[model samples]
Target chain A: MLVEKSAAELSELLSGGEVSAVEIAREYLDRIESINPSINAYITVDGERALEEAAESDGRRAKGEALSAFDGVPVAIKDNICTKGLRTTCGSLALGDFVPSYDATAYRKLREQGFVTLGKTNMDEFAMGSTTETSHFGVTRNPHNTDRVPGGSSGGSAAAVSALLAPLALGSDTGGSIRQPASFCGVVGIKPTYGRVSRFGLVSFASSLDQIGVFGRSVDDTALMLGAISGGDSADSTSIERPVDFAPGGLDGEVRGMVIGLPGEYFHGVAPCVKDAVMKVAGELEKRGAKIEPISLKYTEYAIPIFYLIATAEASSNLARYDGIAYGYRPSGAESLSELYLRARSESFGKEVKRRIILGTYALSSGYYDAYYLKALKGRTLVIDDFNKAFDKVDCILSPVATGTAFAIGEKVNDPLAMYISDLLTISANLAAIPGMSVPIGLDEAGLPIGLQIMAGHFEEKKILNCAKAIESFVEPLRPPL
Target chain B: MSTMDEKQILRVARLARLDLSEQEMSEYARQLNDILAYVRKIEEMETANVRPTDHIVDLHNVFREDRVQSSPGAEALRAIAPRFEDGHVVVPIIIEGQE
Candidate 1:
């Protein structure tokens, strides 16, 4: 029961002394011990360090020196975010032994409030894939079905939170890494507006599109975690200063007289089950005094290709740093540095990673620059322009996070394009640099969870979270049959 | 229609500093060609004069005082290196005749 409570409920108990931080942490750790074996959600579960941190938090509370409401809550972090003295593999053998010397600004900010990290969750190698299957550690299964994949690069974080292994989790979204997995896992996940959260220590997959975000069972808890970790840091030039209080008015579900847009492109060719679930939620919102109207975002079809081209291009450049010299897995007995670089990367990098690097290298290559990379960049401008126009009229856009629910493992793994298309509805947010979130709406014919996506314009965290809270109120929260 | 043959995949792999086996070469070539065919869909959208967005933040040329900020020290930095010497990383020679 302690493990099932949300971070908000746990915080209240912590304040009331009904529970000690250590007991709550230990309960979750015990659950992780039992459940994580079947799910494979975490690559590293640091129980000793977590218990020690929880004890320190308890000590702070006894002395009346508690920093924030989330002081003693246990949380899981995606492996890509750098944790000092903790291994940050980014789900690749390339950095299997790499330990960060510095803490990511977001992680440091969480520590400011005494959040205990349960472990480093697994992910797609370098956040390249849509399913957690690409992780060198192992695939993270959907908590609802053992045969299904928890959607990824942030799949492990989402799965851990969904299975009650932790109250909350942090994830990075480079083209739907956080929101899609959050959908697949039947939890709430958010990708804040670009430059909203500092990316100083979060490992970069695609510099322009990557943003750090949070996952929770409820909207307010996710917003609270987002508020604590958000703010401008000089270390990350892209980070923009914004008001950190994201849960403005406590997500009171006040959508009266609000206009919600349902982009036609998102629902046009989607599966009946996914469309019905999203429309049912939208219809409920409309009945509650919000107006739902049709809107067209013509560039929606281009998101997958543009995202693939731009993201892989940035990834190729970002991952070039793992050359065996400055900390990463290096091979033995190399005759020259070229051989060393080749061997280190060739030996350690996964198939997806190499594919991305080659795609990126090719896109940015001399003859293809104007055609692939530059064309995607220009096409991205249209995508942004499309969202900019729509946000002027609608408070937020409602859509399905993916075309369908979580698919069986290995269903789309070998086919890279199919997996890339899994993120069509979500990738536009990253391209447009807008805030987007996924909250559980209902389920498909199969017993799996389906998530409804909410999107708002640039730096509109309050709008999106408020909308998510509204949806959260309408839908009866569904839990995985554990 | 867009495709990368084996020679092109190998060339790009070399540029990416990755050495591929014979199996990998053919595999990457096919996969890359398939992805490229999909990528070619972007060419369908014409943006003759549209400016490409490299970074979404509108702030250009953010300037701060050029102060020497403290960094994670040399010891901490060297600790994660696969092979290191006296305050230096050991790497195979990159230049000719250096070995």
Candidate 2:
């Protein structure tokens, strides 16, 4: 089935004239149609537009005008990433009818590379929640078990790739949004180092920590998409001016004599099966001539608070732009301007988003600034230092991506604190502004996916991708029981 | 060490421009206190002499040569506005419409 082929495999077929882009797009769109009802992975499926783009790709390839190596491959985009003229609701009622006038740089780059745009995938409203239950659209279910949640705020993107609704997807990560979902859904998800991908039209959640990354069935697919979107964009001053380094040298799994650090802190509360699965990979890598050693990121425990404090503060500042006045949901019959701003946000934003905005505002408030946000900043410095020290002794750090596998849909939804812990294990990477990825390690005792996170030092995506590629050789690419 | 109460939450919601319902304010207050209690762990560390890191990768002022860039255009901007008239975003008059 074309829907079952890896993006790279599909590209090879397209290049060989064995299959047409239209056929590939139609197959995936049909798969999305049939399967997405159970999964709720996509918030919007632009089948007509997707077919048109695929046909254009076919035309280009027929005339030797293909845009890039993986031209005509379909990709799902997380809803928050702006696509001009497309409703970029961000899974919130505030922008339910809002459309961007310009495309996000990452999406624009994908289009330039001849990627057939599938549609926008669902995410948490303003990416405030972890399980995507907070999306105004609905919850995206785990393909392995319909009862469990697909992690969020990139849940839909991960779910899309996991269920084979799309071969590849683009997701933004802030405090484990990408990796956590990737782990829960049993797919390859990467959150590149901060500033690796431009955030030009990506609705900002946490400017300092947010990054756009790729999700794929295979590590190479994600690597190729990451390489395509990475590099300097004048539109985003934070976009690093560096050459793309993580492009697919497919199946390059050599890891001889590599030093891998196992942080003792990350495994503390992880489920036994997850720990066993991660340790099994360490054993396999050791047998392959890679050295594994125990290391301490003493500041690991502080990452959650630091990440939330900084991220929410930035989000409160970022989301303040969505006043009722210029281009967004405006309340009717409001007597005052403040009421317009207040009602527009309070009525439109979900509970989680409100909680975050309030907490963030409190953090940045007059007396609490030093005690909360500033303290978090100083604490973040120590976390960065801890990772720097750890990376000095090892090529990369390995750990479980979460405490356990996917939880039930409503398990942590009501308990905000418990939901925040879903991101605990993965937020340290965002805190340090480093590259991290979740590669499906194996199934848990309950048969849900448990992903092993491989994090590398800043700008060192190559190391983690290589290590994940090696791990993939051991576990093979995971397939959920869709 | 401060736990949020409804009054404080109300002030914060006001500052955040959120018109929280009474029930939401109480619920948010409790939730914020719970989260605040958890994040209070940041107080455990001694942060003296530690420089704050706002940006992970050290970036200096990036100066680009001054040049004209195309705007998205007023018409395009107005098209998405919730209430637009006379090619401008329409909102209630600020000073005159106080409650």
Candidate 3:
């Protein structure tokens, strides 16, 4: 029953004087305090700050002033996004004590919209792992089954929302980080078209593919938060100048003539249960009068390799700044500069991060650059071409968000190959820079949630949202485990 | 590809700035070689005609004006450093063969 209420509904109650913002914040904070102990979803909680913000929201409501949808909504931010004066550790010991002096563009935008900060959620160390076990802090357990993992590196954010710790949360998707976790956690997660949301404040993981996304219990809530926080900012040159659309009126199920493409490549290697769930949802949409057809993304298998090459190369270059100097953990008793850097990074970064860093450095290093990095870049063009060809045939592509339901925490940890394979379905969208969302369809036999992913061409978020809205109407809204 | 020699392992370790102990070097060489062998499967897939992509989206020149903006100033910079000495971050000598 606690998970049934949407963020908008709670905001309405607070605005109508039916309940105070303080009460709403308290309810969520208490839930998080109790549930998060088991999940390790949040690394830090600003309980006092949240209470103060809620009281202030109540004070404003008392004057009969209208408030934004997010005015009093308690939301969690991924620790990777810089929040002024808060510990912005990207789940790495390298940034253990680092507090940013300025806020990231996304964080500043959220604060400007009157969103109450619940706290900073956890993530993989430097956003490198499929499971959050790579976090320097600790593993973020799945909300449904504590023994299992909530897919990551955005696992903490997804788990927080799934556990009802926060009604909505922010996550960054690079090669399916957001959508995969959302699929695992059974929540609605939206990774807007690349450049749909600015990346000004998010700590760099892979600059080109990194995007700030939102996780909500429902489609409308996700759209509402996304619309408020998205738009061009001067601070981020990559931020696009797109018009904001928050109206939920047109999102009702009315897809009488929309073209839906079911990419054949996405079904390869997908588990039977997950495939059945996706096809069942597609069938429901077909009955509703939408056109669904099988389409081909010829170069789909190349996505993972291309993603690793490009992401690692860029990550290696970006992470070069964390050389035990400016703003992060530094080792003690290093008599030399090289020793300072080697010792600091070796001790601070988790194994996964170090692995990728080494891989990336090798890829971009002299002699290997042409064979690895350049070759991957060319393969990337073909991947984009695949999406371009598919989109020309249909307005959007419907696929499974991940290959399967949530797996146990240690299931894929030792086998990095198995872990990388989880991103098989979702990585293509990031490579294409298209808008994609993971909508919870149903739970598997193990009581784990499965998500059906919908992807649209670049800057065509409206089409993606409309299709997701139609699906949301037919399927029951997913409830959090708590 | 399944194994690397001790000399090759040491060379790569130095390149990665990892001063591995003699025992650790051999172990890492074995591990890295195994991982590389696994990843090299991509080389088998024919990509002769495919052009590589640098970015997923057609986003280009996402540039901000080259206007010089003021930072948090020296105080904030000093606050972030692990060891600051008179506006400069103190670190051990890096130049080789000089100290």
Candidate 4:
């Protein structure tokens, strides 16, 4: 059951001298060899490299030169986040052969602390879809229910952690890619405040909304991974120079006199089970010396539009670098530069990606710029103003991560609007540039996992993390029957 | 507002450098129109006085001292390229084209 241990627990075992890092890596690799085929959690498993890294970690430990607390723990990276010398396909055939020559700042920081990487996990094509179905590699199944999607575009990372393939995994959230999947998989996931983490090596899906986050079975483990990967990077200009210490002792799990806002807007269309689960947790928090109050964010409905406009516009521009001549797959038999670019991009990108790119291009094109993109930008300010005003009355806001639990894999794939609506509750935080985290509350009637989302103002991760920790302490960890 | 039509879709696709088949173009036209219809709701909101929020964080010029740092050289960079010649990336010839 070494694979079943949390990152924090694995770190403890390694520091206690009870197990070597190589053995831990080997155990997870063996589990991946057995389980990965069924769930499709990982797109690539670099067992040899992971073992080598684990051996080095063991060497460091024996020499008493322990780098960081989570050293020796194996973690999976979402395919979109680049890992040096490793194939970092963002789940599209276009970049299927694209091996990065540099590590993402988040992964680099983790490697510097001696964490072994267990290869890249699958994702929606370029992180564009809410369901992992858009991935050219294939969809990642939910560990709870094989027929259900694990939720995306970080489905593989969430599934890997849910199935105990890795105790900790790195995911990037653009329009709820991380939190939605974490909710679906019944794991803890965090999307730090905008500019909280560096995005230097992350393949841009939506540059403004994209953020690298961590997935773990527990909040403490997620916090440890967050702490390890956070800090400003010169490579990323938007990265904020903020102090981050997500260590266990950093938070005291206190909720006394804390005001938790229950946003009425987020509950309007949510499933009864999901709303009940969150309300149940809200009741628990109220009893534990926290005040729960009903709050309204009237502009909540505009988040999806704002997010789509901004995310797609950014994506269209960002993905322009994937021309045929660049470092990725190229279609042969192109006689002209225009033909080459067109064929390469069209053939490489998936349906969802193509749709977004076209939408974005049109939104930014002549005659539509002011009506669509610019209008969303102006509305974005109102959304941010809503959050700023709400924060003045509350410490953190509680909501459901998604409308419900994981749906059948192919259920919403063809219905693009339904897939887009999956991120409705979670997109507001991204639009407002605030920190958000999803903690598992419990399950519904069908036995699918449900997550309660906690949101805090800009750079107020400590508040949300503390609230998440309080919820973590109150609820029992729900393990999927993988 | 006008729904997305085939002509508009083709124009955007050309701008985006995506070569779509007739079948794919029609499919995208429908999907894009559906999405635009949903996103069009934002136009109803009044925001004449609100400032456009571009970057989430209020960060201005962040300067770093100019210093040479080790990087993956040109050879390494070219290694991942689909078509690479002697220290340069090979590509198709560029020309003005008639549609």
> lDDT tens digits, residues A30-78, model 4?
9999999999999999999999999999999999998987789999999
lDDT of 1 by residue, A1-482 (tens): 89888888999999888899999989999999999999999999889999999999999999989888788999999999999888999999999998899899999999999999899999999998999999999999999898999999899999999998888999999889899999998999999999989999999999999999999988988988999889888999999998765663466777888899999999877889989989888888889889898999999888889999999999999999989888989999988888898899999999999989999999999998988888999999999999989988999999999999998999999988788877888999999999999999888889889988999988887878877888888788896558
- The Cα error of candidate 3 at residue A477, in Å, is 3.5
Return the clash pairs for model 2, or none: none
Worst ten-residue run, lDDT, model 3 chain B?
B1-10
For residues B44-96, could you state the per-residue lDDT of candidate 1 as single tens digits?
89799899987886778877789987876779878998987888888877677
What TM-score does model 1 achieve against the real structure?
0.98
* Superposition TM-score, candidate 2 onto the true structure: 0.98
Instruction: List fnat per candidate, in order.
Output: 0.88, 0.88, 0.56, 0.93
Looking at model 3, how many pairs of residues clash? 9
Give DockQ per model, in order: 0.79, 0.82, 0.51, 0.78
Superposed by TM-score, candidate 1 places the C-alpha of residue A96 at a distance from the truth, in angstroms, of 0.3
Best by DockQ: 2
Model 3: per-residue Cα lDDT over A1-482, one tens digit each? 33347888987777677878788888888888788899999998989989998888877777765357567788999999999878889999999888888888888888777788999999998888877888889999999889999999999999998888888999999988899899999998999888888898799989988999999988888988888778888888778878875456556656778889998989988889999989998999899989999999988877777777788888877887878977798988998888887887777776667667766777777777777787777777777877888888898899999888988978987666667767888888887888899999999999899999999988887888888888988887665585
- In the predicted model 4, the residue pairs found to clash are none
Provide the lDDT at A442 for model 1.
Answer: 81
lDDT of 2 by residue, A1-482 (tens): 99899988998999899999999999999889999999899999989999999999999999999998788999999999999877888999998998889999999999999999999999999888889899999899989898999998899999999998999999999889999999999999999988889999999988988899999998888898899899888889998877776678643777898999999999898888999989999999999989999999999888888888998888889989988788788889987888888888888999998888888899999999999999999999999999999988999999999999999989999899988877889898988899999999888778898899999998988989999888888785565567
Off by over 4 Å in 2: B97-99
How high is the TM-score of chain B in model 3? Answer: 0.78
